[model samples]
Target: MNQESRRALIRKLVASRGECSVEQLAVELGVSGMTVRRDLQALCEDGRLIRTHGGATLGERATFEFAFLDRVNKNQEAKTAIARAAVRLASDARSVMLDGSTTTLAVARQLRGRSGLTVITTSLPAAAQLQHEPGIDVLLPGGYIRSASPDLTGSLAETNLELLRAEIAFLGADAVDDRGNVFTNPPDNSAVLLKMAASAQRVYVVADHTKLGKPALRRFGQLTQWAGLITDEACDPDFVDQLQQLGIGVIVAPFE
Candidate 1:
């Protein structure tokens, strides 16, 4: 496997197992111990792993961030397509709200080049991604960082979201059911997302085809509540039709 893919697998293994020896990883991955050590060193430098004497453990911040990155790398092409389409919808928006999802992080990456835009986000990674852009103003609400994810949560964050207004909000869901319901995986951030949706004049749920018909932990909102849904073209057409039958607008982002 390629270096990136190998490293991703190593991360997943370590995250799940809590720790792994270089010898164990090499045996499991069918690679040399030297190679596993090298990979582990790289992961340590990236703050995703902490190297032990002959093994590695997940870093303090790696639990959520590693999982987040893993999700971001999955179905990346679809997420990129969705981000392109989602950006077009924000062409006239001066202020935007972005939720702390990997898909929405893709949208933030697309917005990096744009200037004179105010971005309010609950995502630490999203804010970090755009913070270096001279043209975009990134704002993060005050809340305790989630232990399981790299985002803000709590009543403080929800109250802060209520005080702000945005022209448009782009959110990501863990699942989008057949009945036009949107769901989040862990349910901790549902209230924060609901507040974001409420504070925006328009909201769009950006997801990929894999999320269609999937079941998640909690229902955040209905597809009808958002202005529309932006998803990759690989989504089933019949499902799209079903959603449209319910008066939900779905935008299929074609692959570039």
Candidate 2:
């Protein structure tokens, strides 16, 4: 295919799926990763799409949630570091609430064999990882499952959350603007997060640096809702200072 045709196809794919990674687009289009990235760069420059760490999304796709697998692959190293740092918060807590975000899933995988810990989660992925641990007790709330994600949400999940409380809740967001405003897609997802926050004595937002300074469709909550924000070292020092000014602690996970 010609360059024009490839670029056009790229636009179509991103539009239809809301997001597409450079490598995936190359495989689908029978092109090299370099070629696909070039096309994506051009499209982003033209305001046709928004460039993410390893992919591009529809220019106005803030309301669209990327596929779970896609997210799990992006910023892998950073997410791993953030997860390691966030898991330390659970050491002294008797109970913990983990949301279904991929970042939180990383933390869940590390919580195995912790004695006397009650794990409450809406994420099937996280629950699956901890349910069989000898020392950890996993709790799965009842709710409607979102086909796109393993998370259970809706009134049933919200009601289930009200009956339970946790020492700390680790949540995730699609974006966090410079003003410390947190955003996520779909009202249902936000509803569950809000309920989780209410049910926990402390809340921690876990996200990589890529999520900072971006704004998504819905403003689910603010930075103040959380006890602190845990992110990778790739985050800007200035941004960290701003968060500190707001009295929101910032934990920068070490990575090498």
Candidate 3:
């Protein structure tokens, strides 16, 4: 494709998914990473998108429902770091709860093969990964699945959670505000998060630094509701201090 066509396609991809990485764009466009970066640069110059580390996203004014695969590819390194740290916190917990966010899915991946662990989750992806672990028991709360997210939601899911409690719950959020409020798009998604937190003895919100200091469509829980937070090193020091002030254990994982 020509320069104008490539640039246009890049913009379309970014706008549709909210974000697009240099590698993803390159592969999809059958071009080199350099070519993708150059197109992203042009898009940035035109004020069409914001260039992020290794990726480009629609500017602040651009809002779209975050697709699961889109999130899985964004800030992958940071998510892996946060997931590793979260797994350590659950090492001793006999029972755990996991949410459906892509970040929590990372944590679930790390929990595979954990012996004598009972995992209760609303995430279909998480359940699928842990179901085959010999020593791990995976339980799902059967309910209506959100086509876009593949997470179980609705009254059935909430009812199942009400009957059981977990030693710890690892959750994910779309954004977190300065006041420590966790936000997610669509009210039902936040509802499931709230139920999971309420059913756990302790809660840890696993999110990347990009989510910090931003609030999405709705607030599901306050920062005080969580016992700890697992985030990447890219998080702001001042924000970490704020969470610490609230008696929330702040664990910053290294991306490297």
In terms of lDDT, which candidate is strongest?
A: 1
Candidate number with greatest TM-score? 1
CA lDDT, candidate 1, residue 221: 94
lDDT (Cα, tens digit) per residue for candidate 3, span 132-228: 9999999897789886676899988888888889999999988877777888877547777888899999999888999998889988888776787
* Whole-model lDDT values for every prediction: 0.92, 0.86, 0.85
**Poorly placed runs, candidate 1 (over 4 Å):** 1-51
For model 1, what is the C-alpha lDDT against the true structure? 0.92
Q: What tens-digit string does per-residue lDDT give for candidate 1 at 1-256?
A: 9899999999989999999999999999999999999999998998888999999998887786767678889999999999999989999889999998999999999998998999999999899999999989999988989877788999999999999999999999999999999999884689999999999999999989999987788998999877989999999999999999999999999999
Q: Where's the lowest-lDDT run of ten residues in candidate 1?
A: 60-69
Ranked by TM-score, the better of candidates 1 and 3 is 1
**How high is the lDDT of residue 146 in model 1?**
85
The Cα error of candidate 3 at residue 214, in Å, is: 1.1
For model 2, name the residue pairs that clash. Answer: none
